[model samples]
Target: MDKKEILDTLKAAQVYLSRLKSLDNELESAVKQIINTFEETERNIHDTFSNLKVVLVNILNKRENFLLEQAKKAKTDGLAPLEECRNVISSKVVGTNKLITQGNSIINGSAKDGLAAFSKNASLLGSLPEVPELKEVPFISFHVDPTSDNEVKDILSQLGEVSRIAPIQITELCEKPGAILVEWHSVENDDRLTDIQEFRLQRAFGDVIKEKHLLVNFNDCYRGLDTQFLVKDLKVDQPYSFRVCCKFEGIQEWSPWSLPQVASTSLRPFSWKISDDFLLSNENKIAKPTVDSPKVLYSDGPQFCVGHSVEFTFLEIDSSNAMLGLIDQILPTSSSLTSTPGNSFLVDKSGKIFVDGIEKCTRLSEFSKGLKVCFTCDLVNDHKVRVNVDCNEKRVTYDWSIDPDYKMFFVSQFYSPNWKILVE
Candidate 1:
């Protein structure tokens, strides 16, 4: 054959194959469409049959009711209303009664809600929460923490529908005028402050207040401070079971804390764990991060070029303990650094004495210094004496001439070390 004839034959074969592929795609699309239509038709048929079944059942029920009504009339009781005649036939005739029974059963079985939906004892299975009696109104008078209104609402809602819980009112017992005071009332139920812990409104140590001791003429063993007036938000006219004691003039002693006291009426709160790590932790920075913060440590301070981790020196507080903070190391004494020579007491220029190379404690003032820590001994001579230290590294700088000054008001003066001159 010629070259043109060979090329023409190849073109024909390629066109035939293209047409066959196109036909196959069309056939597949048509088959999928037919299948989808069939499924849709089947679903529609099922829905139509379900709806028809309901309609048929309603019609048959009406027919039965009407036929029974006619039969009731034939008995000649002469009921006037159609509904009344149906009810009579439904109750009286055996077959009609069966229909009536089944109809009632249908409603009972099909209907849902309230006591009707539940099996016998299902209502009993779930107990009605004990309704709290309002012996005392839900009062806002207590050591309230920083509680928001929304938090109070949440607590009240859980206890029961709060008929009424009043807002906070502040006042203080007369003696401690600066201290906080509040009062709240529950008009309807004892639901206020029931779950103070859950509401994030419980009090803590940092909350401070002044208290008054009022001894009323009323002699009650249960009440103390003669009257431990409300302080730190403690309630008044409220029975508190606490151990308390008091001391008077010459040789008086404090009383012991009394037993538990309860308000007139309160909900028995469910026991909860004492840990407040969740709510209070956010306010206090003590919630240490497991991962270091200020995330990107800067290169401003150069670390050692060779080591993988840094080695820092912390003052050794105990020979056994491995770790210490800067504050923990400073609080302890330098007792291990004291020195002593064999027992002759010598006095320093400041009228303090020295025995073995250490000092002897002669005066009350001298005892306040490190001289008391040294071994107790009498002066070697009938005379008082003095010694001096010129060494730069001694680190001993206490002067025994003046007493460590202090005030009676504070347990210890924070800024002065002299205040640490602990009483024996």
Candidate 2:
């Protein structure tokens, strides 16, 4: 072979040698990783069981101390009366023995005037001590609570569990009004949903994302064996993210959290209802204004348990003074819905908003006939109710301290005759 061909052949051999060395190093690294993983898992399991042992020992020790005290007290109390009776009987025997000795001396004539001394105490010697006769021995036996052993065994059986890591992934997230339905499946792609003991679904606000599952303030929404869960009472149009983990039947540890999925709820519409006093036509959606003072019309559907939206369209708003709002309830003898202080929130014809019959803001939006005015209401952090009103492209948002015991409803007040409105 020529010199150049020989050099090329040597270089090829060097490349193959380097590749072989690289493979050897990779193999060594993988072995080290396996050893490290095993050590870590062992340490974690040991620590978990150790902590559980400490807690259980503390609880058992407390119970043991309590029972020991009770047993000791029972023994002392049971022995008390018996000891007293024994002492009384022993004293009487000693006295009787003394008298018998004196009498024996007298009979044998061993002492001067012994007979006379014995005769003087004869009545006392023959009389028995006033010891109460025992009918039945009071047996104080300490019977441990019958279920205590079973309870301990049951606790021990459930104390700690062994589990293998499960490969899981969230498949889909479906949105509903004020809720989200989360679905997941095993990464193995097998039908093992039934084999799982339970699944834990958690949710967090989208803005509160974190790198680790423990870092985020995630709330547990559901825990069960089902592969799907529906989380309810969420805010409307608000961004939320969800993740899931699962455990096997015999396993105590949960699988790692799945990648978070984001979703938002759409506006849910509710059916409207007006009182029979103002009924005119069309399933309580249409009502004629009473000639007397204005009365409020309320909804009969599901209360504002979650976020909802309602639209009020004035079919005829010419020269009619009307108000649209929400009220917690209407009293039967009430002259007007706004009569109950702080229970009513309303907006008037001149684009003014009122809370509890007190005006909050003026000229919020231009109110006119044939225009659709939509009211959007939702809870804010479970403490306040937020309402957004959109009228002819003008939007206004208001928040109020929500009464926990109150069930909210949509309401409107009208006094002008021939005034018509369509509620949707």
Q: What is the lDDT of residue 153 in candidate 2?
A: 83
Reference-based lDDT, residue 224, model 2: 79
lDDT of 1 by residue, 1-424 (tens): 8989989988988898899899999999778656755685578667776886798689879977977776665544432344464565554455444445555665687533433433332333333333334452232222335566578557545632211112211122222111221222212232332322110011222211111132121133332222323333233333322222223324232222121122211211111111222111211211111221111111112211110111111111111201100000111222111132122222222334343345544431222222222111112233322222222223122222211121000000111111111111
Clashes of 1: 30
Error of 1 at 369 (Å): 99
TM-score of 1: 0.17
- Model 1 global lDDT (CA atoms, 0 to 1): 0.29
Error of 2 at 323 (Å): 19
Candidate 2 achieves a global lDDT of 0.71
Q: List TM-scores for all candidates, in order.
A: 0.17, 0.42
Residue-level lDDT of model 2, residues 254-371, one tens digit each, is 8667756678777453445655546556645666665655556666643554445567787776465677777776546555654655466787777788777777754565556687
Best by lDDT: 2
Candidate 1: worst 10 consecutive residues by lDDT?
Answer: 321-330
List where candidate 1 sits over 4 angstroms from the true fold: 1-6, 76-424
